[model samples]
Target: MTATSSPPAAASRLDHLGLLYRDAEEYAERCAAFLADGLAAGDPALVAVPGANGDLIRDRLGTGRAEVRFADMAVAGRNPGRIIPGVLLAFAAAHPGRRVRIIGEPIWPGRTGLEYPACAMHEALINVALARHDAIVLCPYDAARLPSDMVEDAWRTHPVMLDGAGRRASPAYGDPVATAADFDVPLPLPPAGAARLVFEGFPDLPGVRAFVAGWADAAGLPSVRRPDVLLAVNELATNTADYTGGPGTLLLWREDAVMVCQIDDQGHLDDPLAGRVPPADSVGRGRGVLVVNELADLVRIHRRPGGTSIRLHFDLGIPPPS
Candidate 1:
């Protein structure tokens, strides 16, 4: 399958080191130029959000991109209906007859915290667009910030979003875990039909939560149980990043009456997230890990080069593996 190609032949223009500064016209002209280049090179057209370093590119091609870049421009809020439809409509209209060739902007620059949903919107939009065009969607985002459902959906559906550097949010920022998380251990072999959702290069937290929530919902888990998995995965995956210096791959599946999730990164751990449970803390210390261990019937750990894999098996219906 195209998704499984080893040593992909094409050099990804998605790296988009093309971040530049200029007026909208200049940006549109540059964008048009990129589109022309893509057209000549048989590449996808680049879609620019208001501020995604797309200034020069968009100025070169597009007459003028819209300012309604994201649904939620505020740094502390949640709103999707505000921005997604417009972008989707733009996509639908732009490629009316041609293939949906697009270079996506999952995050808008000069913005606060709207890139995440925007990324998800781009993801869903691209999936639909692909049905009509030979699409290549490249979205770089903070995996942790993704909406829980979208994250899960991305894992099951969209192609992998890779690790790339963005701003490390302020330490005072709403971080779910801490420095300790960058070192959790990886666990045993995962059940079949599970794969990886790498999160270390994450610039957003909402998306990751979304992925976790989605995973829980799909795995037949209740709402309360969902947070437990979400927190655990966050802590563990963060630990993976601290140790490996990159996002870890997540493997999810079902073993009997349980939904199993294993995280693999370039770290090693002797003491896993299970065993002796810790007491409730005043500030919620070790709670996430403890909850994860408590919820699952089987919590296994494994170690690999530069990383570790921790697997949490949540009950669903089938009996434990004999």
Candidate 2:
């Protein structure tokens, strides 16, 4: 299928497209067509997919494919929560005024059950996050490899659907905020040997970091990853202190092959897109959550009427470099 030659009429709106392809060959062909259209239109373009897919597209695009910024989604989008700020919005924000086109494949056959909810939410929230941007984002789904339900969810998340048959508006499109709210399952309790801490005030930031590092070390988290875990914890704790004006509780534990950290505060995060999009200015409040999402292998948030709880996960098997 060929992509539209030009971006949609509304320069301030986001046009989210979902593509369902049956195989590698089909994916490569459709993606190449879509991205080629974007490149030919002189729009800033980006492709963030798994390494093999990136290679396939590059091979098809041939020389000068290097001009298209390419990122390995396996690494950049390891935590789906980070895709909006670290990948999508980062690209759009860099090229203000000009329309941008991106091919992002965040969901794949390899996504674990634990990671699916966050991935789904990320997909849904993309609509809300980029609502006012002049961007066209194409998200690809491996139809033969992924579950039917996942494909259905894609229809709900995206406003436009593209396949071999071409593009059309998705009748299944729903409010992204409501879609995100549907996945707000309660997080599990910390493990048996979990460590707990409570801190208040900006002065306690250091204490929070220290506490996280200490527990990370005890949990056998590699030295290299300890810093990331600490930074994520510090970001969460800082948000708690700054926004809630009260003490926040933190729990750390090693469950199976993952190290988990949960931060709780008396604050409700109403914006589903908070950490997913970068702040327009340096002083933006959601930057901390953005940092936390980037550092953690997986991050889950539960925000209710009374409070918010964010859980950060680091895989024990993926040790940091020496």
Candidate 3:
């Protein structure tokens, strides 16, 4: 990859670059070099990637590892919707006036089709969220292993692309908002065996939780993650009661490795950035959806003219088919 030019150090904007690496060696070398350059310049550097990849980068960094912060992307970015508020921006906020450098690989070869949309949307939204911050986020994609369409999507989401040929401006870069909406297509209907419940208003929240907890238990969801599933669904139900002013429907089912909890209501979410952005204040309102995003393994939303449907996925620790 070429030593690409970044925005001026004084500029208050994010330099979002997509790194298309062919193998693990290239991925580590490129990422470690980027972090090393930032450390040389006294910038706060962070590496958030899967454990095995982190190890590779750490090895490449060697003694320099001490200067770079590390986070397990598998845990922190399990829900792509949470990466913005919980990982990227949170790290930026911790350092007030300094320009931050981050290597965020939210999408990996292991990412499933069920989780790809959320991952794609998160990458696109990074442009919007860090537009005015003096930060550089380098996202790496495994071009050899990932789907060709996903590799194609890297161009749409990032303004800069780096690979064997070197860095270049992405003429295919599209509007961030439009890219997000393109993935908001309607979800498939729940299968016949899926369990469901209809809720009226706030008064029925307790029952909603019980219904979810019971179904999740029956589906053999790990006991440790049961509360997370319950809390996420309860938040969605509460939002329906508080905002929709109409009854809502809840669907529960198990699809191989994921337990799905979907909520449908007569609510319109015009803000594509909702739940993705942190609330204004710590003690203020509007944290329900944010909390849901932080807890679920994956989240998908389908908003229509008259209503919105939000589906949260909880991984059941089952390995995907090879």
Candidate 4:
């Protein structure tokens, strides 16, 4: 009965729910109950999870149910950096006055090794991002699939935990800013074969795009994906050329099934949620970062005392024989 009970609406501005499950049945029962509680309270609900999990939740909610919003996190949140701005905050902003409920499954066994750290950072940052918002966000973790350490990290990031037994406060909860700050992993070095280009002014943007196109073709990137990579690179390079008031360096290389592009500049990306959120305009401002996130298969940013380095990944299958 406790599992089905709804927590007080005004109990907290942001309720971070960490759902730990061992099997599919357990996940379904708990998640369904949570959504049902939200619906009964007249709160708008959003469920963003992987494809299969979304199907399970939708099935539980029944057919022709129009109250709930659903999105495939695998596509919407492919870059964990974008989840906070693009998915969670966007939904919460759309429904202004009333409390909103979100079921977000960002971390799963399917995440790549390079993506796990960013995913973990995103989890930690959520606590800070939504601390003042009227929202209840449930972040589910598959204990059976993920490492024990990651499960432990979840406890530190989330303020509450929910399961078959019921909900409870997480004793391991800590300052989210501090927790996220600890996850500043350095960007990996580009391959030796990486081609480098330097651009000094906005006038150089066209040249930057041209450089990216040439490298993209040599890397065997499919024509379909080349445009995305070029756009991403152009956006980052433009940010450097315009904002930093100095030359920016662009690097390109191929590393097994993927094309890697990195842009370095003296500018600092102060806002962690910059590119993740959609911008109002197309040129200048944070729109470039948003475009980069939307285009790149994976994006990694390293900000140090000196400058910022952003690496963009594009998945390109093996090249055809010459």
Candidate 5:
């Protein structure tokens, strides 16, 4: 996409733009120009993209990079669920009432099949999350590398599309809420050899920790990360007991080089955006899910009328078999 001019100021407070670019040079040039214009207009700016692309944009910005907040999307946004609360909204909240410019590339070519659904959900939710906010978030996609369906999703999620063809309204844009609901379908069943643990209440919490630690060791999760995994499960399990009235199931397995921990409770998650935003009260049940999103590498949720299943994915630091 060419950065010839900014989106019109009257086009909603949250000017979410979808940029489909051909290659690295195109990505860097347009993104740098977007940030530069924001900076020149005295808008607080942020750039969160993958490492190599971020370096390219940083180099293109020259000395202007000093005034912007930069984050490694690969790390800060490992779980697409966390990008809104931990990155985008957090940046906007820091500077109240002021218009902000952000270039956020949440979906890229290398995203795994298991993670793509969450990324799409994230893209759709961005519309709802920033509907009334004074922020211009530019999201980029690699039209040259990503699959056709993924590119199609860019159209479904963003109301405006910007490419070499120029900016225009997306005729394919669907209601963001409906799109998010469609993606909230059930996750696939775990493999036959996966391990399972059942807990009744707070009394069984210790056993839950032991169960996670054993699998973390077998999955070769490093010692430092073991605590995070444990904390995530503990919080989820606690929520089960506190909110769902006990008797939750925990499933653990390793899919190639990634460790998976899924928690299933017999109650529904009434709030669709429970974990996507930070809780106003520290002691709220929403905090548990928020913590899990922040701690896990990837988080996928399947919530239905009778039950809710949340899966957390963590890399084992081992190469997958060829």
Candidate 6:
């Protein structure tokens, strides 16, 4: 999770935005018109709308670029993380050095900050994707619903514009989403072996840890990093069960520089950022996310129509199997 709040890295080549929309239809129509211009201008683009809003984008653009309905995002597709960012990354890759634009809503035009973490995740994923591309990226959203803090943060780095009605605004820029298509976070050589652990919902924590530790040992990984991995997964998996209930699946694998752990549950989160969110809790939930934020190098979350999924990527700097 490379939030806007995170300490500055080598200065990402990304842009942020804050839009104000009067209505969903107006928003969709104007977005379609803007994208049409962008396409004609020779930039590449990807469009995302609530499942129901696909028609709006399609009707306006008439199909030249790759488009994905937000409905396809599901817990089953957790291997590469949530569908939104993955689709955005894929679209950006297809264009290669061209601009990419993603529309935030489709079903019903709405306010951003009012929706919870999905909008935030939407922005964060786009930021990660835009880190180094020469392409332009655009996002249209309702400003009234957004928190002032988020709006301020997004406006700080991009060209924001107010819409036709005094009620709408958006960011216009050339930061493309293609940057992350080739994103490779460097890590140590992967374990000598790899295996997949499948489970239905959340298993008993102790049992899950034992399984993971045993598998890691067999994979020729160092024992020293085991507890960190084990505890992190346990706390997160437990958190998953507590929030999303007990009926889902989890997958583990290694790709490039990361040892990936993903958990899926049949929970269609209405609010996107509910899981990794900061909560003011004496019950420890807020603290748990804080810990996950501190320990994991990268954390991505997405929700499918039937459920929600979370993926955590751990860096490989620790010793080999101890």
- Largest lDDT belongs to which candidate? 3
RMSD of each: 18.7, 6.0, 5.9, 6.6, 6.2, 16.2
**Global lDDT of model 1:** 0.43
Rate residue 114 of model 4 by lDDT.
92
Instruction: List residue ranges in candidate 2 displaced over 4 A.
Output: 1-12, 202-206, 282-284, 317-322
Candidate 2 lDDT over residue span 1-322, tens digit each: 0011222245438899999999888888888888889878999999999879999998888756877999999999999998998899889889999999999999999998778999999998888778778899999999998999999999999989998788999999887778877877787777766788989889989888888877766667778787788888888888888888578889987767778889888887876676776656765456788788989999999875678889999887864433
TM-score of each: 0.34, 0.88, 0.91, 0.88, 0.90, 0.42
Candidate 2's TM-score:
0.88
TM-score of 4: 0.88
TM-score head-to-head 4 vs 5, winner: 5
lDDT of 3 by residue, 28-91 (tens): 8999899989999999999999879999999999886898999999999988999999999999
**What TM-score number comes out for model 1?**
0.34
lDDT (0-100) at residue 117 of candidate 6?
38
Count of clashing pairs, candidate 2: 0
Model 6 TM-score on a 0 to 1 scale:
0.42
Q: Give the lDDT of residue 226 in candidate 6.
A: 68
Which scores higher on lDDT, 3 or 6? 3
**Full-model lDDT for every candidate:** 0.43, 0.84, 0.87, 0.81, 0.86, 0.50
Across 1-322, the per-residue lDDT of candidate 1 in tens digits comes to 0001122234322221222222445444434554565566554354534343454454444433342122222211112222222343355355665443344444433322322332333343333323333444443332344344433434332334332232222222111112112222333345566744656655634556677777666666756556656776676665554444656677667655657678766654533212222333465333444444445544544445655556665555545445
Q: For residue 310, what is the lDDT in candidate 4? A: 87
Task: Report the candidate with higher TM-score, 2 versus 6.
Answer: 2
Question: Across residues 1-322, which tens digit of lDDT does each residue of candidate 6 receive?
Answer: 1112232356765443445565667766776776777667765555555554556667766676454333222221222233333455556566776556555431122432223233344454455445555544555555565555555435432445445553333343333222121121222333445454544445466667777787666655556666667877776666656666455455666655456777666654343233333444465433444455445545655544566566676666554343
